[model samples]
Target chain A: MNNDILATLSITDATRKLATKEISSLDLVRACRANIERRNATLNAYLEVFDDVEAQAIAADTRRAMGEKQKLLGIPLAVKDNILIEGRRASSASKILEDYIAPYDATAIKKLKDAGAVFLGRTNMDEFAMGGSTENSAYGPTKNPHDESRVPGGSSGGSAAALASGMALGALGSDTGGSVREPASFCGVVGLKPTYGAISRSGLMAMGSSLDQIGPLTRTVADAKLLFEAMRGQDPLDSTSLDPSFYKEGLQRKKIGVPRHLLARGVDADVLKLFEETLKRLQEKGYALVDIELPSAGLALAIYYILMPAEASTNLARFDGVRYGLSRRGESLFDDYACTRGEGFGPEVRRRIMLGTYVLSAGYYDAYYGKATQARRTLSRECAAALKEVDVIMTPTTPSPAFLIGEKSDPLSMYLTDIFTVTANLTGNPALAVPMGEVKRTKINLPASIQLTAAHGGEATLFSIGREIEAV
Target chain B: MYYDAMVSKEEVRALAQLARLRVSDSEIEGLQKDISNILEYVGQVGSIVPNKGETQVLRAQNVMREDILYGPATGLINKGKELLTAFPKREGDYAVVRKIIHKDE
Candidate 1:
């Protein structure tokens, strides 16, 4: 097969071929490598394409020859820089960990490895996964493959972009606050932020411990399901990891709840139009679209910003020029930490750390962090109630399509991109971003997406509905 | 728009210090503006109908397990040298660090 055909093949299609011996893992990896060579320089998607990928593919082929029948065998997938693969440089696009190598594989990566997946390489991300756009990557920004002048929608922008540009069949990205979904939306791919605890988080560099979920980014809902299945379930390393029985799966009502009140404004007109069209298509397919009111949905972004930073601040304390990562010596111990971190971390990370410190500090803890937690509980309750009535809650994954590379200079405006996606993170529900269609911007067609969020452990429902939208 | 609570330049420096990050004088002004704007926006959380002590529901749980050889994280158990290689300064088998103890000069 030509490299383009192999590189562009969905994980589902590629697996079928691999199973039949119609395609070798070596050819698949090389096809992906061919695309990476063609476009990686322009897209800046992969920070490092693994040098041993050829050997990894050969090993998988040998395993297959020995009667191994793993579904993901020999499949090449792009991994976010934050998901640690042992012995590989797992920089979260931060300078501080420039030389740091993962001593252990992240549970998700381990599961993928066991399934016989190939690691294409680590893709770029915002430093510490702090920003909505990959522009904040200490190394540099990952440009959208659709429009090079635009962003791929961040934190996981590189992973999304890599897959979108055919560098890999699928990719892994961690979503703290819409990092995975928003980029998936922008890059015209399917992104799933599985229910919190559905997948183990061990060895994945911590961001917001409560919100971070390592999820799959793929071209099709089935492809996403394929990858999510291999990596999901309990691991002793991540106490938060769930047993399959944690949340009882409910019957699908063939209903979707749309919080239209919150979407009255902020969402771009074109994007909203496409969203309604998708709803109409689903309705024509015998699905009910109910207008649900989630009052707290309006505050989801505000709550996410406060709580995520608070959790992040505490989570990041491990990087104080100590046991691992970059270290700097100073006249005193304190100076050593201050200098090391100040030089190592990028601006967005510093901003979040400071924000977290301020919220968790003695004086403001109750007013900011404490209040955000209360609001979070309320939001979670609201989502649970809504999901009980409907199979999934729907919204535009992002307020608009991918914006120009330097468009959202103001931090607040840049944050608005995640407005529709953060609710799931806050509520611990699974959300999927599926490309609805494209909207024209600046005379070019840019991808727009629809977000469908299901109740905790309702990923199966999400996959079904996501497939519906993909059909639409 | 009014910011009920604002982070001044001095407070930005203090927060940076508390976070153990050294920010240049130039970064303080930007941090002050950006943080103040964010705090003001996120402060809207205060308007949420209080969940009446329900905030504790989100409080973290102790995830520690008995010290034993088990689980995937055990992959880190014997790779002491690889972990040490990431340390910026190390002496043979130990990570070097600055001493805090002082004697009367």
Candidate 2:
């Protein structure tokens, strides 16, 4: 295989190559390392590239030579720093845990290692996965590979960028809101946010635990399927994990739902045109398109902000600089607690934490946090009803294509980028972002994407339809 | 509605304290202006009217399984130490903890 192919090849192709001994694991890891060195300077995608990756690749090759048949043998992948890899810093891109090394491997990391995937390095992200863009990352923002001046949509921006720029064959990203999908759309790569409890969150830095899920970012639909099939399953440690039966035997290209009303508003003309064209192509390819309306879609952003921040405030409260990370010296206990957090967390993280604290505070709880939960219930019900009619709901992943770097200083505008994708997260539905060719006429190179959302335990439909859509 | 944009400087300070964030007076001024703008935008959510129905609570109850607790997982400190070793600062056996708690003497 060519070096470029080794670097950018999807998981399925790489696996076939490895199985056939067409390209050795050493070649893939070395190509990935070279790609990282070439692009990461501008992209700022990785927090660290493990120097010992070649050694790990060698070990995987040794195992392959020994006749071990694992699904991910000899594949190379990047990991988000939030997920623990033993002896690696799981910073979560937050200064509070800047020094904290994982005592043990995250269950998913352990599983991937067991499957024989080589760890390339860790990708950067928003501190504790707080911000919509990676601007809140303690390390620095991961720039979009398409245009270095623009943001690679965040908290999984680095992972998406790595996949988009051919730095890694595929990478792992966590979705708590639109972290994975939004970035994938920005970078024009495939990203999946599986059902909330589909993958274990044992070592992932908690950020709204209910909404947080680790998913895959890859070059193609089948590549995503390969990684998903490998990483998914119930883990004994995570109580929220369901039995592994939910994701099995997916159907091939079938009827897909298009929520015209939900996707019609606030979307750019070019993006909307691209979305309609995607539908047309899918229809031509024999996939049935059904018109569906989901009114709860408008309320998704509001509900997510409320619920996600509330959980985040609680989840982030554990990092007081008492255990690890940057701590400030103080005369008294209160000063120690206050000073450390005040100095450690960035402005965006502090803002969300404050907002979360406000919503969950007394008197206003019933009005804000409580009511948001009720809205979430209604949203879940609406989505469930909608899914019953259509196997998968499709929409533009983002309202518009990636904007210029430093274009959106306003938080509201930044949050709106997730408008199309966040609902799936709020309702715990599985969603995937797949590129649907480029938009016409701008030097911007706007890549349009269609989001495929499946019902709870409907990842099978997602993967099957994704495979079909990709083939076309 | 315009008055919503006119946030008081004192209110911003109080909110910061309530959120346990330390802020300088200069930062508070900027925050007051920005937060006022944000609240004005976020206020759009107030338009949402839910039906008169029993509210569904999604409170995260402790999800600990009924497994036997063999006490805290031991030797995790060594792992924690390996992680903390990368930090620029160090004290002793314990990762030099900030004075976050007070014991009654």
Candidate 3:
């Protein structure tokens, strides 16, 4: 097989070819490695290309030779640095844990391993998955494959970049407030954030416990569905992991909802045009598009910032430089922790930790965190109510196409990129970002995406609708 | 539509201390402005009227399993050494840390 052709084949196509013995797993891994060798230096996608990739592929070939049949068999996959793959470094792209090796496989990784997936390497990400762009990664940002100067949307930016650049066939990225979907949008790939608790989070680093979920970034909606199906299951390790029956799947009504008020402002003109075009295509495909109201969604980002920081601050307290990761010595134990954390975490991570402390602190908790919690419930209710009328809610994944590497300097502007995507995370609803079309920027057409958010346990609806959108 | 709430530099310092993070003097001003702006933006949640007698929604439930040595039974043991190997400061299967208790106190 032509290496270029093999590198670009989607997981579904590649699996079929593998089954027919038309292409060997070694051929796929080598093709991916060739692409990585050519582009990874400039792309900075995979933080480390595992030295054992060939061995893993050889094992997969042996498995197939033994007549084992698995859908993900012999697939090369890039995993975000936050997910543990057992004995591999899972630094979460932070200096504090730069050399920290995961002692156990994340539940999702275990499932993929069982399916015969070959581990390419851990991909780069925003340190602690805090930034909207991968710019906050301690190692450095992953660039967009479409445009070298532009950023791959993040904090799952590396995973998205790897897939878009053909460095990997599929990738696993953890989504906490658009980490997966936003990058998927910016990179012109399919990114899914399964409903909270739908996928187990056992081996994934915790960012915002309530909001974080591990999902797949793939070239096609069917590939995303296959990966999601393979990974979604209850795990004894994660208390929040839910069984398939935890929430009943919603009935498909062949309808899509649009909250026009939210999109009336902030969204880029070109992105809005593409989103309208996507909706029109869907409409022409025998689906009804209805204007739905999610009034409380205006507060979704605010609630997310408040809740995510608060939870992150609590979660990150574990990195005290004692048990594992980077350690530093100071005059006193307090100094040790202060200096260690102060120097260990990046600016973004420190800012978030302090913000979390401020919100959860006395005299301010009720004003910020408490109210945010109340407003979150309101937003969840609005989403649930809105879904009662429509099969899924749709919006532009990010306000614009991939922004230039350093475009969003101000923190607030950067946070606004997640305006539409954070609502899904806040409500624990499953959301997918599929490439709607591209918007021109500086002589190059950059990808922008339309996000479809479904009701709880409504992934099937998203897959069907997403596939239609992909077809269009 | 600007929110009046502003996080002061002193407050940022105090919060940083509480969070066990040390922010240099140079970074304090930036944190003050960024944190205040973020707080003001998120404070919009305060306008939401609470429902009558509504309780906080708690999705977590007690998930209990029988307390038994399941890892070894499932052939998942041998992780003890791996876990121990991660300790920054260790002494023969125990992580070493500074003593907090002083008898003289």
Candidate 4:
């Protein structure tokens, strides 16, 4: 089979071939590398394509010969810069940790290693996963694979781009806010952010401690389930990790709730048209679509921005000059810290840290952080109320298709893009982004996606619905 | 009660100091403007009346695990030397730090 065909094959297809000994892990790795060699330079998807990948594949082949048959045994995967894979450099796309090598594997990475999956390299991301675009990466921005001029929606932009461009069969990305799903929507792939605590976050760089989740960016919903299941489970290291029985799997209700009020103003007409068509398709298939109201839904982005940055500010305080990575000294201890952090973190990161500090400070805590937390509880309850009526809630993953690399110059406008996706993070509900169809922009058919959010512990529902959407 | 929706230059500097960051003069204006705009947008959360003194019950519970000295936390994941290797200024296994406490001259 052609290398292009081999590289482009989905995990489901690749695993079957690997199981039957029809394809070697070397073939899969080399096939992925061939495309990476061709496109990575321009796409800037991978920060580094590990030189030892071929050796890893050879070892996997040896294991297969011994009657070991793990589905991910030889599957090559792209890991986001934030996930630690022991001994490998995990930068979180920040200059401060650029030279820092991981001391231990993230729980997710360990699980994948147990499954015998091969790591391609750490893909680029927004520094500290702060921005919605990979442009915030200290190294550089990751362009959308579809159109070079547009950005792959970000934070997990590189992982999404890698999967879309056939650089990897599957990829892992961490989502806080819309990091995973937004990019997945932009790149026309499948991304899942499981219910909070569903996946252990040990060894993943801390961003918004409360909001951060390691997710899979893949070509198909089935591929995501395979990766998610492999990575999900309780970990003693990450106390928040949930047990398998924590979230019960319920029968598909075939009901999707649409919060029309939130979508009425901001969503692009063409994007809404595709969303409506997807709803109509599901309705024709005997799924019921009910209009639901989440009164606090509109405030989700506001609450998320407040809460995430507040958590990030504290999480980032550990990056003082003494411990690791880039450390700079100054006249006094205070000067040492201020100078090191000032020079270390990117502008967006600094901006967020400052925002977080302001919110958590004495006078403003009640007005900002305090109110946001209260509102977050309200939002969660509202989502729960809505979920009680319907199995899942639906929305356009992003307001529009992928935008030009530098299109959103203003920070507020860039944040407005996340309006539709932050609700799930706030509510602790599992959400999936699957490409619905394409919407044309400037003579290019950029992909638009539909986001389905299921109740807490409702990942199975999202996957089943996601597969149904994939069929559309 | 600062409701003007504008973070002043002095306020930005104070916040930067509190956060242990230094904002250059040129960047401060832009950063402050951006911060204020975000504050104004997110400030709407204040308007949400929380059920007239209803208690906010967070679903998060304390996750306690047995403190196994050689468990995954310390044994499986933690490698002392590998962690020390990341330190920029280390003396053997100890991370080197400046003397923050200075005796009166």
Candidate 5:
């Protein structure tokens, strides 16, 4: 295959070629680097392309030559800036840690490397994974590959864009709310937020540690399943990591749940039209579709905003200049500490920190943070109840497709992008965003993603149904 | 939810200080006005009547593990030390900072 074709092949396809000795890991890495050089300017997907990718590729080739039996042996992948790859800068695209390099590999990165996966480079994200649009990054917003002016939905914008533009066959993304799925939908790729604790978060930057999850954004559902299996399992480093039992069962049912009432509000007309047609198409494929009601689903975004920011505020307190990372000096010790944080963090981050701090503060904690957590319990219960009735929950990943970068100047409007995807996060349920189809006119092909959420450890069901729907 | 409930520029400055973010005086005024406006929208959550005391807060069930040495955390502390050393300012074995408390502890 030529360089573009090689770069575009999913991880499974690339690995099969490598295992058969048809194409070397070196060729794949070089092709990807070349594609990055040619396309990254327009896509702005990557903040830094590794100068040492060839070396890693050579290492993978050496391992394969020695008869290594790993499935991902010789596959190339991208790590989002938020994921640590020992001794590399894992900046989450912020000035706060611009010069800070990670000392250890994240559990997911370590597993992938052990499986002989070659590291491409770190992709960009909204600073601290704070915004719905990539525009919050201090480095500048990542443009959608489909349209230059529109944003590739964010926090994971660079990861989704890199995969779409062929910089890497697959990339890992961290989703606190809908960071991964929203961007995947906007870019027309597959993104999975495996059930909470499904993938280890030991080396991933803490952004709302309770809600954060690490998963893959790839071109196909099979590829997502491949990466998810490779990186998932129990990790001692992350106390919250789930056992392998969560992924044992696969989706075999012909029945699926479609939540029409939940998805009806705020959904753009074109987006809803495409979503309804997708359901019709699935119905025609011999699948039983049941319209279900998730009563607490509408409150997902509201609950997420309350709980995530509360966790984020406490988690980010460690970046105080007294420890490692960036800092600014002043005449007095207090002045130095204050100035460093004052300048280091961006506005949205500061806003969240303040809101989080206030909610968790002594007086109002009972009213805000306490109440949000209670609602989250109800949300999780609702998900469990819905899953008992069907194999998967289907909905549009985002209410709309990629919007213009500056279209949502108001912060609340920008936050609405996560409305559909947050319920999965709130419920700690595994969900996948599979591209359904496109809309008319606008250069944007409205990628309607049906969210397939299985009960905890229900990845098999998700993948089986995702494969079926995607095949259609 | 109008100017009557408006967060004043003075309060914004105090909030900025409390949060360790620097806001210019003019910026504080703008933020005070802007944040108050934004809160007015999000304030709808206040009207939501949550069930009485049934919701249990999600807490990390702390699990203590055996003191086992592993490869992943192996080089972590050393790397942290190295990065701390590289920071522009530091006192022996620590990243030096302006004392946070103005008064003696």
Candidate 6:
């Protein structure tokens, strides 16, 4: 098979060919490897490509020969470094856990293994999944495949980059705030952040436990649905994991809500144009476009920054130089902890930790963390109320397309890129980022995306509408 | 739209110590600025009028499982050795730590 054709094949197409004996798992693996060899050096997508990929592919082929078949059987997929795969180094692209190996597979990985998916390798990410761009990775950033001068959009940037560049047919990413969808938009791939608890998060590194979800990034909406189906289920290990029937399907209204006030300012011109075009296209598809109000939506990002860092600081306290990960000794026990953590975490991680510490501290808790919690409740209420009237809420995934690698040097500026996508995470709603079209950059045409957020457990609606937009 | 939230160097140092992070003197000024800027940005959360007396209900429920030795019957518990191997300092099967209390105490 031609390498280009093999590399570009969707999981659905590849599986069809595999079932018909037109191609073997080895052919798919080799094609992905060829692309990795050609582009990974410059893209830096995979932190480490598994040395046993061919061996794994051979096992899948053997299983197929034995008359067993699965949807992802023998399919090549990229995994984010944050998801554990038992015995493999599952660093969240942080130096603290750089050499640490996972003791067990994340539930999602176990599911994929059961479905016979071939693991390519772990991809790069922002350290501790803390930043908007993969630039915070302890290893160098994963550059955009469309333009090496720009970033691939982050925490899951590497997973999206790998799929966009044909290094993998599908990939897994964790979304806390816009980690998965933002990168998917920047990379011009389909990224889905399942409704919270829709997928078990056991074995995935915890950033913001309440907000975190493991999702799929794929070339097509159907492929994304396939991966989501394989991974979504309640698990005993994760108390938060919801059963498939936890959320009843809602009545289809065929109405899309747009909070035009939110987009009135701060969005780039071309990006807004693309967003308007997508809304018009949806309107033409017989979906009623209505103006809705999410009055508290403006505060979602602020609430996220406060709540996420607070949760992150608490979760990261386990890394105290005693149990696991990097350790350094000092004069006293306190010094030991200080030295170890200071040397172990990167700048962004430390900043967030300190910010979290400050927010959750005695005098400031009610002012920052406490107030954020109340606002969060109000925001969730607002979203629930608006969602009652509309089947889905639409917005541009990011203010602009892929920005220059170091363009957002200031942390606040970078945080703004996630402005439109964080509300779904805050509300525990399913959100999908679909490529709307491309916007021209200086020398390249970078991808822009439209994000559709559905009511909780409304992933079916998202997938259906996302397919329509994809087709358009 | 400037906010009154400004983090001082002393506050940053205090937070660094509380968070178990060591910051060099050179990095303190930068941290002071960065933390102040971040706090200012996130402080907008405080602008929302607090809804008092209405108890907020969280979506999570307490989940309980039968307490028993649970693992794959395939000797997955032996992975404890791998966990033990990750300890920075180990004596036999125990992780070593600095002694906190002196005999005189």
Give the fraction of reference interface contacts each candidate recovers.
Answer: 0.76, 0.35, 0.72, 0.78, 0.35, 0.69
| lDDT (tens digit, per residue) of candidate 5 on B1-105 | 112336667767766766666665656755766566544544444444555655455644887888877754544754657666556577776755555567757
What TM-score quantifies how close candidate 2 is to the native fold? 0.92
Residue ranges of candidate 1 with Cα displaced over 4 Å: A247-251, B1-3, B52-67, B71-73
For residues A1-472, what per-residue lDDT tens digits would candidate 4 score against the true structure? 8899999899999999998889999999999999999999999999998999999999999999999988699999999999998888889999999899988888888889999999999899999998887989999999999999999999999999999999999999998999999999999999999999999988889988888899999999999999999999988777777889977676467888999998889789999999999999999988999999999988899999899999999999999978798898989899889989999999999999999999999988888888888899888889999999898899999999999998888888999989988888888889999999998888899999999999888999898888888897
For model 1, how does the per-residue alpha-carbon lDDT over A1-472 read when each residue is reduced to its tens digit? 8988999999999999999999999999999999999999999999999999999999999999999998799999999999889989998999999888898888888889989999989999999898888999989899999999999998899999999999999999999999999999999999999999998999889999999999999999999989998999988887888998865554468998999998888889999999999999999999998999998989998988988888898999999777888888877888998999999999888888899999889988888877788888888888999988999989999989999998988788888888998999998999999999999988888999999999889898888888888887
Compute each candidate's TM-score over C-alphas: 0.97, 0.92, 0.97, 0.98, 0.94, 0.97
**Of candidates 5 and 4, the better by TM-score:** 4
Off by over 4 Å in 3: A247-251, B1-4, B57-59, B72-76
The local distance difference test score of model 1 is 0.90
- How far is each candidate from the true structure, as Cα RMSD in Å? 1.6, 3.0, 1.7, 1.3, 2.6, 1.8
Q: Total backbone clashes of model 3?
A: 0
lDDT of 6: 0.91
lDDT of 1 by residue, B10-55 (tens): 8988888899999999878888899988888888887877656674
Order the candidate numbers by DockQ, best to worst.
4, 1, 3, 6, 5, 2
Evaluating just chain A, the predictions reach TM-scores of: 0.99, 0.97, 0.99, 0.99, 0.97, 0.99
- Compute DockQ for each candidate against the true complex: 0.63, 0.36, 0.60, 0.68, 0.41, 0.58
The reply for model 4, stretches above 4 Å from the true place, is B56-59, B70-78
DockQ of candidate 6 (2 decimals): 0.58
State residue A362's C-alpha deviation in candidate 6, in Å.
0.2
Per-residue CA lDDT of model 5 for A329-382, tens digit only, reads 766765675678778888788777766766666765666666667777777777
Residues A1-472, candidate 2: write the lDDT tens digits: 6778789887888888888888888999988888888889888999999989999999988898899879899898999989999887788888777777777877788889878899999998888887667878989888988777778888898898888888888899999888888888888998899998888888888988889999999888888878887888887677787788766456544778887887646898989988888888889978898888777678788778778878998888876665667778667766676778888888878777777776777845766677678778777878898888778999988888777767888776787788887888888899999887777435668677889999888887887777766776
Candidate topping TM-score? 4
